[model samples]
Target: MPKGVVRKALEGFQPYVPGEQPPDGEGWIKLNTNESPLPPSPKVIAAIKEAATDALRLYPSPTAAPAREAIARKFQLDPTRVTVGNGGDELIELCFRAFAGAGDTVAFPTPTYPLFEPLCRLHEAAPSRHPTEAFAELPPSLGPDPSPLKFIVNPNSPTGALFEARDVEAAVAASSGVVAIDEAYVDFAPRSAVDLLNTHDNVLLLRTFSKSYGLAGMRIGFALGSPDLIEALDAVKDSYNVDRLAIVAAAVAIGDDQHHRKVVDEVVKNRTELADALERRGFEVVPSAANFVFVRPPKPAAEVVAALRERKVLVRHYDREPIAGWIRVTVGTREQHEKLLGALKEIL
Candidate 1:
């Protein structure tokens, strides 16, 4: 390749870094990613196994109607109003493609999901980051000229802080363009923006089967919005974006409300217990509504992360300002938490 042949916008573009996954799961308490420590429902597993037949010879449904309808039924929305994707990440990128363009602005709260800014940059859109506490305090003039695209991670990631539905509704009302609410962690929260879809045509609620449903390996996610917004996403998303096995697994998983509730209840319980324990240990832990806790330990976050790694217990650590000293720990199984707590005791 010739020098400088790449697009100028690609220059200095930084990618989103995900949680580290050690090659082997042996002897490691993996809690960096907010994945459910529990396994998927038996029905979901059986559904995937059933789907792995000679059907692989043909292409899957382009619209992924089975999974989409299941999601709609679960949320009590119309099937036409939901668009399933490869994952929540793809749905997020699709929003940028369908709504914003180069030089358009994308807004989100800082110290939230790290992927949003990179997606904006990949599409050459300007990124506008606001403090999470001040996210709803948008200027009156923000909706006019730039036609900003907004992204909200409800029960926001890394920190697990949740914004009330009223706050989100107000932000959507103030926006001229699309507002995508990433609700990957909403099952652990008290409320959801799905209710806002009834009143607001500009709002899109993104969800995943990864966290609550324990289908991370399947990589299925979806978006719920007005029919118009759903159609827009469908227009830009790749045909057959969600494969057959994933569609089957997600559909089965979505239908099993009992199993979903069981997993979520367990995680929420563990989250509370873990947060209380961390607080008791003198860590300034942020109250979380998701399946993780953001904590400011007694020592530097980098040092703690390194020490934990040495002890084979993993947690997320960020190296940015404002939240640079804090670490995010995914609420794991009770036994896993005990191991993490033991490791922390030794490290501290």
Candidate 2:
């Protein structure tokens, strides 16, 4: 074999492993991915269809004006402090590129969205993983080096455990690093750390249309921060990071608050029912403020996952620290939850 040319940084990079999507399946219940079971608001669908024309020949707006305006209005933030991305994931990678670099360190809680560590490595930043205590608390210190950027997931992925706003406030106040609060699931949660933005210049809040708005395929997400930080991200991002269709879709989705609330309420209902059932089945279910439940079943989580897969039901199985034996299941439709619980009973 010929010797291949690759950067030294590429040698040990471990990429994020998102949940799988099987190609061929019938009657399969997909609960592994945390996507909304609901469809995009009818208005959003109409907007996308309306935009489908010869206009695609032209490049999307370099600024994504309409979408940014909608996001600003919906979130009540200044448009100058907002920047959209291909998705929330891209915003995260952009943060590493803009802030943390060689010799710099990035710290985030363990059992989080796994992309943060590899993103740090790809940017040549020394990424540090701090294991959350039994109750899922950020560690006391920043370790050997001060992290220039700190990422935290509110209603954290997989574990679905929400950090209290007070605790988050204290952590952000204590840290010298820029605190990036990833509120990907905040629509389901009762509160947000975004309120801290008024007082903390170092805080950045990220939002996505993929979950509550049911636009995952649209690949639209936005970041809110101080103008200086927003400018840094904008300088680092491509001239046009968001596309035309996504911008249109996201704007329409944000405008229809009524539909958004209806879907979220349904998901919240299902989430509660699913969590309660799991608890009744002898599982230790975490109190989730997100649209999913992290449950430690009496049976081995891996085995339960495997059995559920065999029965055509899919849920996430984690092998990471602090939550190794737990499973993270997205709250599907009411019918989907009933089907899942029925299968889980057979497996258990």
Candidate 3:
């Protein structure tokens, strides 16, 4: 190692590990990543093709204007209050970069998205763990923290549980710093904290086209908040954060409400069915508002995951806090779920 080669920030930083993608044709069932099993809408594909001409030679719009416009129209927010990113992950990173700095504390509920902690660390900020014991349900013990920045994921990850809106509101109202509410899975849920936008200038609402819009490949997401907050994010974001094809495809995806509705409805339906199936199989399944079911299987999560893998099925396994014994299974097609259930039955 060279002297003075690295910043102190690099010492404790850990990168986020998204759920895995199986190697080509190696697995018959893949449910690890919480990605939609459906393909992107045909409209999105057409837009991508249309934008894929000689335009590839030119740089994409730095601000991703059209996508922001479509997102604003879809969500009934002002265009100026909206900003697009490569993915919801980018927005999370940008939040850290924009408001948080070395030695500042970034607080978030434990066992939520793993990325939040990693991002805080990467930014050389102090990462404080505020734990949620019962599927990320804010306990009576949790209230405002002294941290200058907080990240809360509604319908939190891995555990597949929704944080109550009132709990979030209280946290926002009492906290002193920027409150970022990550609603990446909110489209699958009944309501959003967007209504709180007017009441709290410190709040930033994050949404993604990855899950519900089936645009994970295009990698687009956006944030809504006060115009000033949006401007702050714009100041730090990459000049061409989003590519041309992604901008057009994401816009069409946001504009096509019919397609979004259909996909969400199907995901909700399958989520219920899969949860029920797991319950019937003697697993304790958490009630999920997101597109995945988190369950405590009869066997250890690692054992069950390994068994499923042997049967050509893949589900996420985590060795982390708050849900170490559980597995998060994404809602796939009916046939896919059946295959998963069959494999579990055989393993049991």
Higher-TM-score candidate of 1 and 3: 3
Screening candidate 2 with a backbone cut-off below 3 angstroms (N, C-alpha, C), the clashing residue pairs are: none
Candidate 2 structure, TM-score to reference: 0.95
lDDT of 3: 0.87
Name model 2 segments beyond 4 Å from true: 1-3, 142-145
Candidate 1: tens digits of C-alpha lDDT, residues 1-348 = 234977888887787888987787478898998889899999999988888999899999999989888888988888999999988999999999999889888887776789988898889888886764443233333334345578888888878888766667777887888989999999999988877898899999999988999988789899999999999999999988999999899889988989989999999999999999999888998878898999999888899999999989999998897788989999999999999999989988
lDDT over C-alpha atoms for residue 15 of model 2: 74
Worst 10 residues of 2 by lDDT: 136-145
Per-residue lDDT tens digits for candidate 3, residues 109-187, read 8878888777776787888788777775775343568777788888888777888889989988988888889999998
Per-residue error (Å), model 2, residue 281: 1.3
Model 2, 1-348: lDDT tens digits are: 123565876775677777877774577888988889899999999999999989999999887889988888977888988889999998998888888899898988776887887787778888777777754565555333368899889978877888877778887888787888999999999888888889998889988999998988899999999989888988898888898999999889989999999989999988988998889999999889888888898998889999999988899998776678988899999888888989988988
Error of 2 at 279 (Å): 1.1
Q: What overall lDDT, based on C-alpha atoms, would model 2 receive against the true structure?
A: 0.86
Model 1 segments more than 4 A misplaced: 1-5, 133-146
